[model samples]
Target: MIPMPARIIAVCNQKGGVGKTTLVTGLAEVYTQMMGKKVLVIDADPQYNTTSALGLSGPEFTLNDVLYGDESNNQKIFPGVAADAVLEVGEDWQSPNHSELGLIASERNLASRERDSMMAREHRLRIALKGVAEEYDIVLIDCPPSLGLLTVNALTAATHALLVSEPRVASVEGLAEIVTTIAEVQENLNEDIDIVGVVVNKVRKGRKDQDVWIEKIRTDFGELVLDPLLPDRELFAKAQAAAKPLKSFGSEAKVLRADLEQLARAIWKGSEA
Candidate 1:
């Protein structure tokens, strides 16, 4: 019997430093370690922060190969070589209790793809992942902090999108750009693409500005804003800097772990529905 296709989700934000890559890895870790689900992370961002945070280094084949293909050899192209580029960060490898995690790594060369003179580039990502994405229960794409070709490809490929933002004026303002981009993608690209919700990330305590913005977002977007907001904790950065999951921190990471698990569960429930 063949496996069902993964629910591809793009974790997107048009504003830089909104923790979009962090959320992508957090959700992937939750789905894998906490829920025992097979997960794949596509590092669509040219920065390749997700690939680095997951403790993968010097990946021979990256998302660049998948997107542009091995044109030098005339051997592989879109949809055919996607599987060839995937690498596994296995259980108990970087962090404890981790299940096998699939990764289509990214490199700085991917930034060039944005300027490539190619037709139908927006659909290339979707075409590449066609059969390869089915091996996992979920595929999370870490989109760049811009509404450029790479992001367009990610949105085009995703079945759903989770908008990430910090409760700041700039980040909040940038949400409209991404939301409008999603709307345009729905209108012109993938009609099936729907926004899962907005993730309020990096909320700091005692910041009245953060509070005001959170309230404003809730008023504006309603229930689309997910609850139990992610706090601006040093542990999140520490874990990423250490190139490990929160589980590696043991009890010290309990609170952030719970928050991530809760949001992951919400996403899981919605995806299943």
Candidate 2:
């Protein structure tokens, strides 16, 4: 099974094209299909890549509803519970094990909220998630590639921050900024939160530079760098293109499925450590 007691992890990175969305969607698929865990994925990113990759559409009363509730029109954005805002996507990949997938789909309207200068914008997501934290074993929030209000909101609501990163000089160049943002959030927004670890994404084997940067991350963050680094594989691209989970490929991509299982184990114990 996946992590217990409901974990809200923001698989985030300030820079785009670093496999942020891929990791989030992939892990959700792993937890549900392999372990039969109830996983809730919040596609907080305006790009909505997670929604599309999972074959989900932006439904009515989406995350936009919670972020910009119309108090004047008596529109309760978090109607009773945040569970009311989620929709199950596609079909279960693993049968007889109760693998369930839930999503809070996003739309282009989500980008409009970026202009919102109100302080309430940062806490909007956290407040909405509180209404339904008890319903799932794990909740993954896919953040946009910017450390704006949306990212801060995810940091504020999250129990742990699972930073999606690459083992390269260019990728780690902005690591300082990411650290600063998380520090600010902890000092101001959520004191109980912690950065669980960093997942080095799509590490191309035999790259000497990758070895150098991998050592750098460990030296800088210590135990915060999660192990069993995910490799760059063609299967990842195929799975996304197929709009299906890695496990859905069955024996064709069994090795990819094993890689994801290792990732899940590393994240499952993150909260306690």
Question: Which pairs of residues clash in candidate 2, taking residues 3 or more apart in a chain or in different chains?
Answer: none
Judge candidate 1 at residue 266 and give its lDDT. 82
Global fold similarity of model 1 (TM-score): 0.94
How well does each candidate superpose onto the true structure, as a TM-score?
0.94, 0.91
Number of the top lDDT candidate: 1
Backbone clashes in model 2: 0
lDDT of 2 by residue, 1-273 (tens): 432457888888888878887788788877887788888999988888888788776578677667876667553445334666788776633335776788898887888777776546677787777747657888899988888888888999898888877888767865657888889999999887888888888898889989999888888888888777888888888777767777777797787678778888788887753
Determine which window of 10 residues in candidate 2 has minimal summed lDDT: 73-82
Question: Model 1 lDDT vs. the true structure?
Answer: 0.86
Name model 2 segments beyond 4 Å from true: 1-5, 71-81, 92-96
Q: Weakest 10 consecutive residues, lDDT, candidate 1? A: 90-99
Could you tell me the lDDT of residue 267 within candidate 1?
Answer: 78
lDDT of 2: 0.79
The model with the greatest TM-score is 1
lDDT of 1 at 126: 90
For every model shown, the clashing-pair count is 0, 0
